[model samples]
Target: MKTNRLKKSLLGITLSVSLFVSISIMGAPQAAHAATANTTTTAASTSVSGKAGSIIALGKNYLGVRYNFGAQKGVTSSFDCSSFTQYVYGKNGISLPRSSQAQSQVGSYVPRNQLQPGDLVFFYSPIHHVGIYIGNGKIMHTYGSPGVTISDMNSGWWSTHYKTARRVIK
Candidate 1:
């Protein structure tokens, strides 16, 4: 009888330990998955910001370039609004459609207040113009007269004509 009780006790102890280990093993992958997802998100955000900075830097290199209504692609001498965005973003591995209307349809929509650098901001009712948000309420784009320039988005024609914005990064 004593031997039987000892065997029962040992069996119970072994079952308990097995259950605990099973639970721990099952939970480990879920915890690791959560941690991995968080790390990936952070890394992706950092990479997007870096790319945005590079695109803006490249755009700035053409700050005063002439504007042509139907500017030729791959030609840097003059740029229409969409051409400017296409050229700059293309240089950094992001491809934008040739027309502002088409570019607006590519990325996810972003609220006006949540605009970030490198976001494509559009103007006009049907989206006639496109610009690169350069932070601080300013956008870099090419237009009549000044050609390529930075304009305030808060209080001017830009503000009134603001239609929508899109985020292409990530």
Candidate 2:
């Protein structure tokens, strides 16, 4: 009788320990999952903030480089209208196509009134010219008088040739 009782008692203890371990194993992952989620949220937020700051910094850095014709491929000293836009955004970690026409195809279409910093403001009928929106109804581009300068959207030249604006940044 004692032996049978001892066996039952041992079995009960072993079963209880197994259940406890199982519950702990399952519960541990939930805590870990919560921690992982928190980490991911923080990383995403930091990445977005970093990107916005980088874009603005890039815009400020390449303010006055001269415009070059057919100069969209490499990071040369001077930049054409399209090249200037590509270089500024590229420096901010965004890769754009070589031509303004090509770059315009990507991202959401932004209306003139909705323009923001880092947005690509396109111009000309054939879509040959492009510039970076620098807020306040002004765009930064290479004009004949100044290589890279800010001009109002309502400026006579830009107003006539204004095609579209696109937002490539998230």
Candidate 3:
């Protein structure tokens, strides 16, 4: 009985050591890879967000510039929604098309819930207007009275007019 008990005890210890060794060898690399992957993802997101901030900052410089229905591109005195986005993004080395409809087709389509700052948000059923999302559900855009101003995207007129969003930076 004593010898059998001793053998069982030895077997249990051997199994435990084997498990520990396997986990230490195999699990270590996987854990390390996961950590590295997480770091890479965070870094990429930070870089993208930083670019977004720069774009937003540039756009805000033209606040109250005045809105024009057919405002020419590269004009700073007055801007239509599409021209404002094109000019601001162009200044940051990101080229956007001349019109809002054309601009919408250039970037990756991003859902409203996944919108980030600097995203080009479009409105109207067939897509007529565009704005740059400035986070907190607000967009910086040019309209009738508030040219190059920030407005909430989640309430009032904007809420019902929400159409789609696009990510041009990434």
The TM-scores, one per candidate, come to 0.71, 0.64, 0.71
Q: Residues 1-170, candidate 3, lDDT per residue (tens digit)?
A: 99999999999999889778745754454344334422212212332235576667667667788999999987677899999999878876799999889988988999889987879999998999999988778788999987889888999999899999999896
- With a 3 Å backbone cut-off (N, CA, C), the pairs that clash in candidate 3 are none
Q: Ranking under lDDT, best-scoring first?
A: 1, 3, 2
lDDT of each: 0.81, 0.68, 0.79
* Model 1, residue 92: C-alpha shift (Å): 0.7
1-170 per-residue lDDT for model 2 (tens digits): 99999999999999889778756754554344334322211212222223444544444445576767886465545778877777667755688888889988988999887876668889988898888765556676775647877777777978888999998988
- What is the alpha-carbon lDDT for the whole of candidate 1? 0.81
lDDT of 2: 0.68
* RMSD of every prediction: 22.1, 21.6, 22.7
lDDT of 1 by residue, 48-136 (tens): 23667667666766779899999999777789999999988887689888999999999899999998788999999988999998777
Candidate 3 Cα outliers beyond 4 Å, as residue runs: 1-49
Clashes of 2: 1
Clashes in model 2: which pairs? 68-79
Winner by TM-score between candidate 3 and candidate 1: 1
* Predicted model with the maximum lDDT: 1
Please report the TM-score between candidate 2 and the true structure. 0.64
Instruction: Specify the poorest-scoring 10-residue window by lDDT in model 3.
Output: 37-46
Show model 2 residue runs off by greater than 4 Å.
1-53
Between candidates 1 and 2, the one scoring higher on TM-score is: 1
